[model samples]
Target: MASPSNYSSAPVSEFLLICFPNYQSWQHWLYLPLSLLFLLAMGANATLLITIRLEASLHEPMYYLLSILSLLDMVLCLTVIPKVLAIFWFDLRAISFFACFLQMYIMDCFLPMESCTFMIMAYDRYVAICHPLRYPSIITNQFVAKTSVFIVIRNAFLPAPIPILSVWLCYCGKNVIENCICANLSVSRLSCDNFTLNRIYQFVAGWTLLGSDFVLIFISYIFILRAVLKFKAERAAVKALSTCGSHFILILFFSTILLVVVLTNVARKKVPMDILILLNVLHHLIPPASNPIVYGVRTKEIKQGIQKLLRRGM
Candidate 1:
């Protein structure tokens, strides 16, 4: 319905990320805490990866899957946090057009990849608990390798169209993104052209990818819970539950924050824009920071691995 003449002929070369304009006066105070969170996420995941790599006793399918998760978390933190800290600390918020799309693409791919990894980890636990005998064969190193490949291909290739589609949309002058990072929706909405298709694809792709993973994870946990309940020995049941406790906590926090962000956005009238933006930013940080700590504290092998690494370092 809008005429082509109404839109500017010049292309948008860059975008300004307006990170929480409502709190501009005091936003610099966020620098210390956000920098700390970023460091914690990077350090924790790095330590977990190192501990797993150095501990040969941990060279199993479960720990391999955990290593994959740690890698994803670290990559995700690295991709999003540094730019965010730049915005908070030095007021550097300009992102080139290509870089913005690249960030959007990476976030699109990695967020769902992380979800898929969690689902695979859930499946690993389900097999370990429900069919311990078959776990050795069913969840072999080969299985992890295959699943890792599948996760990479499925997540990376399927979401490739999101940013591509966004690129086709004409941005006729408005180049300000309201969020900290180049989130898909935040960046897409800036286009002067009609972006309904972009919105539709993003919604469909996101729900189809993340929604199905969540469902499969839920089913896996249900089976795990059923299997744990059936164990005749109380100690066996407790051990089984303990094995899943950390994973359960991690997924719970991840899904809960994601769900809250989605709900707040859907009901944006009631939620303040600053709060919504804060939630989106924290969602990226909190999970990565907590994941390694939860697993290290709850899983004896990882705890011991970390301890061994610490002792060797000291």
Candidate 2:
């Protein structure tokens, strides 16, 4: 007979399994690479934020936005990676209700905020390229600060209803979450109740905010490309494109990976699911690591400022 301690007599509240199955063996080597990547990403993004804030020379609109982006990326990483690493390290499968809710909310907050920030950055580029003469007047420091505040407030409150509503939904049935993380999709799928409204909200948010943001981003880049082509000097065109190159690359990479994951998951691709999920973790972590380095490499102002900071330290 099994001991009472060994069995969950509480009707087995929930069974969350992140691993694929018994036949699929776990890879220990994957953890080493992942940990290295996580540390490097966190370090690079943090360094970028510090370098920009500490260096007086980086006090420009572009670098200011870059600093904000780095901060957001850090938030993004914190929301997902730490819990993931913990789960891997300790082989923990279950999370408390409050902890799960907090994780969901934080992830929700960062996702929308990051998208909004990118849209704002697009507007910044639009102003700089489209109306250089009025750029200063249009995108005033006050306006940027206000917009940043709005980004936080908008996401912080808007996503509150989502997790709250979901948590309250009936889960009296089997509570086995098949994903690596406590994803909204998996949670909603677990519920025995009608999740039509939840699906509607997900679709609307994905298509409207996320989808529209991407569209607007492309439009801004289109105009930017036009502006670049019109530049009389070769150097001017190269410089203008270079200013946006790193960000555009990162955006494209992330968007492509995200879209692939969504489609594959929706289609129920079993074999690639875990691998894609792992890649999603990398996708979240890589931006922070690469963002700062991209700016540091591309922008003279940031480069000079970082150099100055290092000199002072030495």
Candidate 3:
């Protein structure tokens, strides 16, 4: 008989997503919740986008960033969740190579874009609260437009080679991807060819993009805290604290989930594979789900816009 490495001479045109827990009949129960999360996320984000677009009063730097965040959250949800629900509900896991690469590209690219967005939002807050007078000049319409273009270009180009590298890899062995979505490692691990480089590159690229963003955001918050503390007026200080609360809570959730994922990935041997799989799925879904509820609905202007829209409907 041929050696183990020799078994995969035929090409891999598709990958089978094994999905979480691997519970055949029981997995059907998961469809309702997953669909609900998708619906909630998409509906909320779309509503926020529409509110921002229709309201001229919301056409400012802060609301513009929120608009971008809402858009990103919607795109992020669409990229990974629908196929996942299909896999869970219908057991339709087989994804063609081109489609898989496209999914991988969107997954990799959009996440870093999310990180960039949070960082940019932090900076916007810093400028607005710390230097109110100069805020209008500093964080202008042109600045927001430029930053949006930069975020798109940076993330689109930087993580692009990752999916391309995966596409080029020869998957000669079993083509089963043991995850809900086509993640970089889950798919590359199936390659008969060694994928050591892919893992290392992804690790480095992930940390570099997300890590730097986190550090910068932390620094921005530090300055924000300092500025808030310097204000002698208690009411002003309280306003600043309240203003940052919702945004920070959402950011904290985003950061905490990502941190857990990193810790769990590093400790994969000790943790159950199913748990790891669940964490991976939740990492993509939770933040998107949290976006509209945590940030959009909580924002005063968005709530006002919603009320206005409802009144108009009446």
Candidate 4:
């Protein structure tokens, strides 16, 4: 038999990923709760989507945009959760090349799309609250449909180049990703080949899309604030603000999580990598999990609709 030292020193395969630093100490304590959250998020998000689609009361532009947001959250949860649960429950951490790429692709794609949706929702609020008289004409059904189509087209096309450029850069032979799931940065960092262009592309793409969307959202809200100030009634302004509150909170949380991960990940030291990774996963997973319930349970109309649906079903 081979010596114990020799066996202990065996080289790890390039693609055999052991994500956690203390893999041996890994337990399934978080798995059950995470799995439950995953199901809850998916169900709530999907139910919201179905509610908006089926309800004639929710046929307006605001509701249409909300429906789209619900769908985006549902997609985001679906893309990340199954793999996460699988990794925890079954110890199935190794993902193939194509699957990893696809996961990363979906993540990058949806993130920006969701940002766009938030921006559009901001504009909707601007029209509704800031320009109530003109809102009906400006946010017409046809225009809303067109905006929805534009969001879809932009989302599908925008992140296409990131994946292509990413895959083209040589990953050396070392394919072990450090995170629980394949992220663009984690995957790119494994490459032994020249990735200056790849890194530049990722930074530029991330900053450009994320920055632009955030700026637009801020600007829209600025005008909204000015308009709300003009309203003499304090309750009127509060009501208007409440309409956009959940989306704004969700956007702030998501963007902050993203900025923290992106800024920390590329730092010279690797000390913060594990923490950053955990935060990154939590950001992506939790919003999708909590958003629907947050918006649904908190909003009286949605709560009533859900109650009605459940009652009718029974």
In candidate 1, what are the lDDT values of residues 3-66, reduced to their tens digit? 1132345888888887785887787788899999989999999999999999999999989988
Misplaced by over 4 Å in model 2 are: 1-19, 22-24
Worst 10 residues of 2 by lDDT: 1-10
In angstroms, how far off is 294's CA in candidate 1? Answer: 0.3
Go through the candidates in order and give the clash count of each.
Answer: 0, 0, 0, 0
* Model 2, position 279: C-alpha lDDT score: 62
lDDT (CA) for every model shown? 0.89, 0.73, 0.84, 0.75
The model with the greater lDDT, 1 or 3, is 1
lDDT of 2 by residue, 173-249 (tens): 55555555666766777676887787677667656667877888999999999999999999988878877787787
TM-score of each: 0.95, 0.89, 0.95, 0.89
True-vs-predicted CA distance for residue 254, candidate 1, Å:
0.9
Model 3: which ten-residue window has the lowest total lDDT? 1-10
Most lDDT-accurate candidate: 1
Better of 2 and 3 by TM-score: 3
Clashing pairs in 3: none
**On residues 1-314, what C-alpha lDDT tens digit does candidate 4 reach at each position?**
22112121332233433445454356356688778878878888888887777666767777777777778887777787787777777877767778777888888888888888888888887888888899899998888789888877877776777777768866645656777777776777777667677677777877777788889999999998998899899999899899888777877777777777767776729645567666666766777877777778667777777777778789
